[model samples]
Target: MCRRFRELAAHPTVLSRAAAAAVALRAGVWSDAAHRFLRRCAAAGNLHACYFLGMVRFYCLGSRASGVALLARAAAGGHAAALYALAVVRFNGSGGGKADKDPHAGVALCARAAWLGHVPALRELGHCLQDGNGARRDAAAGRHLLLHAAARELAAVSSARRRGRAGEDDDGAAASRFMVEWWALTSAEKPATAAGEGGSCGAGEEDAEELRLCSHARCGRRETRRHEFRRCSVCGSANYCSRACQALDWKRAHRGQCGAARWLAAGNAY
Candidate 1:
């Protein structure tokens, strides 16, 4: 099946717009040829092409209006990523000021994208449901969806590893990258008052060291109960909400700093 797809992909002109966009994407967006292909396909009203080109325009080139128009067009056609991208914009009020934020619309768009099997959308929708940010609070349903999303993420990573493309430019890798970057942005924006000195939630000064956030910077979830999170086997310092978060943290930052001596010196001895 992979060989057949490669054979079909070789004929870019005959490929569907999405396939063509994928080829162009693999060619690297900085390549003039890839850029031209994306532009031409986007001009031809190809939804996937519009999505890629619009993201480049909005994020890389800073062409907000044109990029948003294209993204909106693709989203209107039920492009999952486009819908999710627009949802992020709405949630952040990227179109205007904080007052312009439309969390309800963002939640609605995320729900649509989640229905289409966009993993990030599913995860974001779950968070929204849990917090009642836009939708009515449903902690049980939200937890179920979050667990489902985590399962899908693990499966995606496992599939990528089986294909010998674990770190390649695949959807799973892309989603992980998005999560890392998104968390960085949100962490910077979060108020200092939200977390205690040790990144613990609802902690008094005396119990500050008793509970802590997941050690993964991209997953700053605080432990809801004492000893709820698992500590790293190697260092016994870093905590993680799930195996997926642990893997991501290891890849992103923990690999270099994960040493028993180092953690012990930092007063994380356990």
Candidate 2:
């Protein structure tokens, strides 16, 4: 299949080159010929080829500067994986050279990638938010994102188990174990608030204040005639005054807890 794909990749078309690059990546074909094909495809503006070639150059060939440049190019084109890769590099200062470790920039890049639906990016962003490494501390939002990521991993595991694919179960089990550990850690950090401490008026005031404010983090805009909030369709635990706020909240926090209510109703361990 690799040989056949390479032959087909000889064509000058963008799709052919991209397909060949993808196949080569999957087959771990890091030969000179494969590199040449990837370079050609990347030069022709194939984002997948650019990302694969960048990774190969960075990890396999140790061409850090060149690889990072290629990754940056791909990221500028809105490649989520490339953006996540750059975030990792920025966070760790692993590529050598100046070793300019910028945690804030890394977190921002991760947030962008998460917004683009990258799972690893979501996990990284959640960790950053939880620890307040670069962004403001928001334990609730971080937990929400982490749980969502775990749920997504669980969904993947369930699919793999159903398919009976070799090695997938091991991966799923590892993800599940990580999720369990994370949940335990988060649970341990919960504050011990005394029940029945506040009077009825205080509870009522809190509930009214919560109802009047938007659920999106830091927005806190009180609902008014111009800004009528709507409850989330899946969890209904939060409300948003506008679609933009809703989308931001979903990307940053609610995505993890979204549909969780349904999963619980169906007796799933979400």
Candidate 3:
């Protein structure tokens, strides 16, 4: 009865006499009901509501694309969190591909969110600095930000763990992981795996089979107008710097190449 009454008051044509029309959601609410409420409100074109649902989707509760697309739309419509999320979506190619990952726009949106003291945005700014993601890779600046994020995470965790804290949040796992990832990055004695070359070795290497080892034979530049060539295609079945190179390379290795190409082409999913 009260829900319907509040809804009617918030209607556009209604006088909106009530001072409190916005419904308050308590923590005990089940997931299905919350999804239903968000879905209804989002479908009604409520920008803020869509942003909320987008966060739910982004944090693994729903499909990756759906969350990002909705967040991009909401950010375009001026939702603040959505604006921050748009930056992330752009960075990850989730909303679209590299062409749509507008780094300039992402930086602007991130700055706006940072101005509002948004915690996630602060962490993101650190990430941008560390990765040179449309910005300079200033390790010092990134460390400062990761430290700030660590402090905020600790404070929130302390508050949440206090007795009678109402269980309104469960940020412990998220905070711990953030601290670990950030501290590892900030430390001068970083983990060895961070060195790209170190990741390429070992008998059980993850990329062992898929990666084609460069023979470096002749070690010549393989472009047509350059030192000269035999540039292997996807399966090493053909080497063609040009159609002309194709004939030369074919005479040298074509029969074997064709034999392998025939057997391999059928399952080249990678």
Q: What TM-score does each of the candidates earn?
A: 0.59, 0.54, 0.44
For candidate 2, write residues 1-270 as lDDT tens digits: 999897675665744345422533432223567668778777877777677667555533446778788889989988887887778666655444234667789899989988987766787788778878778999999889988876875676678778886323331122223223322332343333234333211111122333344566634233322213567977776876444356667878887777875477679874
Give the per-residue lDDT digits (tens) of candidate 1, residues 36-66: 7677667666777777666655544446788
Alpha-carbon RMSD of each model: 13.1, 19.2, 20.3
Q: How do these models rank on lDDT, best leading?
A: 1, 2, 3
Better of 1 and 2 by TM-score: 1
- Stretches off by above 4 angstroms in model 2 are 1-8, 15-17, 24-28, 97-99, 160-270
Error of 1 at 188 (Å): 22
lDDT of 3 by residue, 29-140 (tens): 3257666765666666666556655644543232456766767777776656577766655544442334555665666777677666555566667766776766778889
Of candidates 2 and 1, the better by lDDT: 1
Off by over 4 Å in 1: 1-33, 167-270
Error of 3 at 102 (Å): 3.1
* Residue pairs in candidate 3 whose N, alpha carbon or C atoms collide under 3 angstroms: none
Q: How accurate is candidate 1 locally (lDDT)?
A: 0.65
Which residue window of length 10 is worst by lDDT in model 3? 217-226
Number of backbone clashes in candidate 2: 1
Q: Report RMSD for candidate 2.
A: 19.2
